[model samples]
Target: MAKDFSDGIKLSQPRPYLTRMMLFLALVGFLLLILAPRIMDAFLANPGLNGLIVGTLFIGMLYAFRQVLQLGPEVKWVNAFRRADPGLALPPAPQLLAPMATMLGNRKGRMTLSAGSMRAMLDSIGSRLDEQREISRYMIGLLIFLGLLGTFWGLLITVSSVGDTLQSLNVEATDSASVFTSLREGLQAPLRGMGTAFSSSLFGLTGSLILGFLDLQAGQAQNRFYNELEEWLSTVTNVIDVPATAGENTTPEQASLLALAGQIAALTEQLHAEQRLVRELAENQAAIRPALEELAGSLKKRGS
Candidate 1:
């Protein structure tokens, strides 16, 4: 559904990914509420590492939500500007599209925005979005790293504990009862270490999963907004006929071929002109050579 602004503008019914993102977050919250006790115990097992992972995941979610939120307003703003009457004023555009607004505002009279100009605007907007998503991606990687770090730490502790337990085992006891008690007591250290490893892995993997889904939603919203802006720009984009400017329809290879063809045609024309000049020079020399021979014979007769 399109949102209606106070200025009487309606959206073009974009992807609605922002609403979907909110619903996804809501579902996540509900699941966490139900699993709160289990989650608490897992975190308590490896509080130092698990606590840090949760904190990182929370920050990632915050950044992802902000990305979606920022995109929503910008999408609305672009739609409003696109649909408004050309003679009237539009509501203020979002910061993402401020450069475009400035370009249009600074125009003298009868502004003609070229396709290249629109593309430059989209590039600026896309670069900013890429920067925003980079933070979320980094957080996801960090969560996995923390998980693996905890796993190795736990394994190290488990290995050393097992070795120590085996060394202290007094198998010299003559009675089975004393040997069994020593073995049981020795196993507790390794079991606690194993618990730390499993708990950290579970929490870290779960947190990353949640953050990944949120980032997916944010990416979709940004893509939709970008496409919407592109469509809107096309409406105002003018196709200029410039010999120096390459057309979008032509690839670089095609342009190079065209240049080569032109050069070949010019060379062919020059060669034809040179051939015509050479033919004229030969005809003139043949005609003058006969006249000179006749004059030389007449001079020989007069001298004799």
Candidate 2:
């Protein structure tokens, strides 16, 4: 059933900007992962940590690319729905929005599409829209955590080396030259450890920034698609009060509908006028009440 509808309805190509942005992010991420090791000697020494950071970045980038692909079908669905006839018809709807069309089909009474039904349709699509956002958020957090983890791991190495060197130094057995050599070797280890710490931090921060931007762009695109869909649905889909019957006298029914509509409109105007009069009376009540009370007292006194 899904295949049949998909074959019938034309799908638009992915937006160029989205495609280009994904490509740009992929290329840059690839370059960074490749060059980081050669450019920074520390990465070469700690290949495992650097690899993990780069790997995490690639995962985030791929997820963003997948989100862009999902949005393409949505764009096509919105465009088709916008161009479809306002009356009840098999409008071009995406798989995600197929429930809406189905809901309309199941209607049997004089009930038109109500605001509640519209809300339900939008809520159905909202889940799909939120999926990418949720994934992006997780990726962004994970990338940052990995970076921080690397930084702390490098710091731990530095601390451990310092402790080992201090424990190895002997005061009684080593001469001045020997002690000096021990100190020099100990200091060198810490410097190397510091380099690893800084290298991991640098890569981690860069990865997080890239993922953040991609996530932001994806969110914007999703929002735009949703707004367009909502506007189109609002304008094209209507709340049909009267249900059209098959092979029956529609003339009397239509005339009755028109009469009912006219009556409702007249009643609405009448209600508004009555409400205005009530408001005016309420506003003047404070001033008028005292005068009316005074007149009543005067009339009583005159009677007495």
Candidate 3:
């Protein structure tokens, strides 16, 4: 039985960036399990600040993962289009690759493969990538900021308590036992203050380190996706598309797409015009051959 391409090629499964993310997270979890006792003690020492840092770190990780996930559709869109059969419907393209869906041209009510001058396309992709990464970058900065805030806050508490303890101490007391008892009670407050300082610092710094690594993973994924798109564009040649007419009921998105297609069509015309000019110049040179030969003959006879 022969299968018809009336239906477009089946799209390949989207590649995932979660594998490395999951593996790295698992490793962190294992390490945390081993240090559970120490971590529990620190959390107890300053529950308020430590809990905040941990919560923010979790949110940032989720955001980073989502950014990487969004990149998957773009790669999938490009790959499917590259392999798609002409006049057959393939899966829908992501927003970033929407230009390709139109730029390829819709012929006889079906898609046809066409690619040319990837610079504009690449630039568009890069700008979208920048927009997506912006939030993740801000989250990273926020994590670091929170860590620093906790450190200074804890230090302030320690400093204030130590100053109060010093002021309350008596140099000379009528009864030595009473003086020692009062001194011990005041010293306890300073010790607890020191605990708050060290515990908050520990959790804040650890949370930042973990989030930083996840951010690095996200960056590498984006770079790889961009490079793949660039390489695919290199091997393609141009096709001049006829921009579709927009109807009164057309949505803003569709209108924008039509405009982009029109721009590309204009550029293609310019390229073809330049090609025609070069061909004309070559033909003119060919036409002058006989005249050039006669001129040379006349000059030779005169010289002789």
For lDDT, candidate 2 versus 3, the one ahead is 3
**Better candidate number, 1 or 2, judged by lDDT:** 1
Worst 10 residues of 1 by lDDT: 1-10
Tens digits of per-residue lDDT for model 3, 93-185: 788778756665464433323343367777877888788778777777776777677677777877887788778878687888888898888
TM for candidate 1 is 0.73
Clashing pairs in 1: none
Q: By descending lDDT, how would the candidates be arranged?
A: 1, 3, 2
Estimated TM-score for each candidate: 0.73, 0.62, 0.66
Would you list the rank order by TM-score, best first? 1, 3, 2
Instruction: Provide the lowest-lDDT 10-residue window in model 3.
Output: 1-10
What is the per-residue lDDT of model 1 for residues 87-120, given as tens digits with 9 covering 90 to 100? Answer: 5677777788788787765444334567788789
Say what the RMSD of model 2 is: 12.8
Model 1 / residue 154 / CA error / Å: 0.9
Model 3, position 254: C-alpha lDDT score: 88
